[model samples]
Target: MPVTEIESESQFTELTKNDATKLIVLYFHTPWAQPCQTMNQIFKTVADSKASDNSISFLSINADELSEISELFEVSAVPYIILIRNSVILKELSGADPKEFINSLNQFSSSSSTSTSHNGPTPLATATATKPQTTSQPEEESEDAVQERLKKLTTAAPIMLFMKGSPSSPQCGFSRQLVAILREHQVRFGFFDILKDDSVRQGLKKFSDWPTFPQLYVNGEFQGGLDIVKESIEEDDQFFEKALQAAA
Candidate 1:
């Protein structure tokens, strides 16, 4: 099918949630971004090549026009691509590499037809599964730099959540529940989408010595994951208050 331009969130939802679609290639771009100009053509070419496949669909979203959808995925940059199959994130790619874009679509389109599970795709190759590009790795961040960055991030707000997706659209059940709990308690928190930044995603595991996500940090200290946070609230109704007060 030809690439459909997503005009609104409702339209996007209707098209993406259709049962017939086995693979959805979402291109998030902004007209002002220089990189997006190049990626626009590349995306169209790739989409055109796959036009014969009825089970696969391509969508182009203006990050600014459909702000809610962009924010749902925590899209911080333009010229981004997200592959989805059955509501699960298959892949996320950033930047304007034509070869990488085409190659990824080809890989996932073939796999989407055979994959029966509703779960996200398995790691493409260990640590690089969430890596932004298929090739052309970014310079490694020094350990000290990573540590310093994590330190600032943890304290970026009084309450911080490092989760799989944004608060509005949690990618996993655990993350959704944690976001609900915070909202129930009327807590204001900042969140970092681990899916967007592999550096923070991997570094945070060691930084807090927590191997899992939906991690809650209170006043720059490790609070816990979903279960632990629930337990903390159960133990003390004043848990969030105490944490914020301590920072104050």
Candidate 2:
């Protein structure tokens, strides 16, 4: 299959949801990351080599350009690859290890072929299964459940910024300043609005041991709030890049 560059969120959602028989390989990246550029070539090579295989599809998505999709998949780092079938994530790989990535793909392909040969291919389903199915929908999450979700949300992007609103339209002055600083430094980040989810807002305070909004997380670790971010930037000129590299 040809490598498809996902230009929009709707297109990405459509492709992932509609294709159940084919293993959808989603490559999440950003143009700024040099490692991502290198991985792009590797990903394309793999896609071309497996072109004859009808059970696989390749897609590349710029994480910054499609923040919503990145957040949906909880993409924490660049050069991230995720394999999904029937809208269910089968595997997720981070960083730019071409050898490991190719091995993973080969293993998945082989397993899929074996499964299909034995059981036959299943028909594609329309609904996406982002979360595990339950017998009945719950009205609210437990404390522990909320904590777990907060942890996941914080690591949803390489540079996760939990704020009152989005980077474009901050709902508070602190969040506005933080967004401005990030933009000034040309930081590619993902954000969550605490106001939108009361559970996350309250839970993250205890989870990270930090009681504040506009919190920032690097990799899967909590970095701190806006003030600490500013201090780090002032202390290290390449703070953002260094953090991402260290995470990668």
Candidate 3:
């Protein structure tokens, strides 16, 4: 079995973000890190064997050489393997335990094999909740008509996100960051692009009585936008820690 070296950040992106099927097992660390060396051997051995069988795609990256890539994966510690398919990360693991790593793959395979077919991976929002309208966009429709349409979209799911843009292409940094946070947590969500609906756009402003886009609602409960979410993360680092723990 041969090991494919993930040299540049673009190559790394091509490995995980694009291939999707090519499971990335990045080994992020500096040369001086003692535990990193041990983990690299463990990963290399597993990846070499697994790659031959086409069971998994194996690649290693030195965190020092690709700081940006590490940042994308949010690698806080060394000797870690982040398993990803497409843009969705299946899991992450730390340390140098061959048996546990193999067990993880087995479990993942078992679950994925039985998993129901989905159009694509799920998103973070599960519902929608908000309704507001105005007369300025007369060319479109009446405020009441627009409000009714918005109400339908808001209630499309039990949890929904009304923001600057949709899931694939966010219109603002806050929305983009917000989307990333939800995906990293593996939360399935729905989003309404206010940019597409002027009525809903103004309607949400008055409906929530809160002036802002990128607003999040879980189970129909309003969760504030980016700054608030970041503040929440800052208050409890455990926010990311817990999600990473589950990934591991």
Q: What residue runs in model 1 are displaced by over 4 Å at the alpha carbon?
A: 113-248
Superposed by TM-score, candidate 3 places the C-alpha of residue 121 at a distance from the truth, in angstroms, of 16
Model 3 agreement with the true structure over 174-220: per-residue lDDT tens digits? 88788788776655556666776676778877766679888865544
Candidate 3 lands at a TM-score of 0.43
Q: How many angstroms is residue 237 displaced in model 3 relative to the true structure, after the best TM-score fit? A: 20
Q: Give me the runs in candidate 2 sitting further than 4 Å from their true place.
A: 113-248
After superposition of all CA atoms, the RMSD between model 1 and the true structure is 14.2
lDDT of each: 0.77, 0.74, 0.61
Model 3: how far residue 161 lies from native, Å: 29
The TM-scores of all predictions, comma-separated, are 0.49, 0.50, 0.43
lDDT (0-100) at residue 114 of candidate 3? 27
Give the candidate order by descending lDDT.
Answer: 1, 2, 3
Winning model by lDDT: 1
Comparing 2 and 3 on lDDT, the stronger one: 2
Error of 3 at 199 (Å): 51
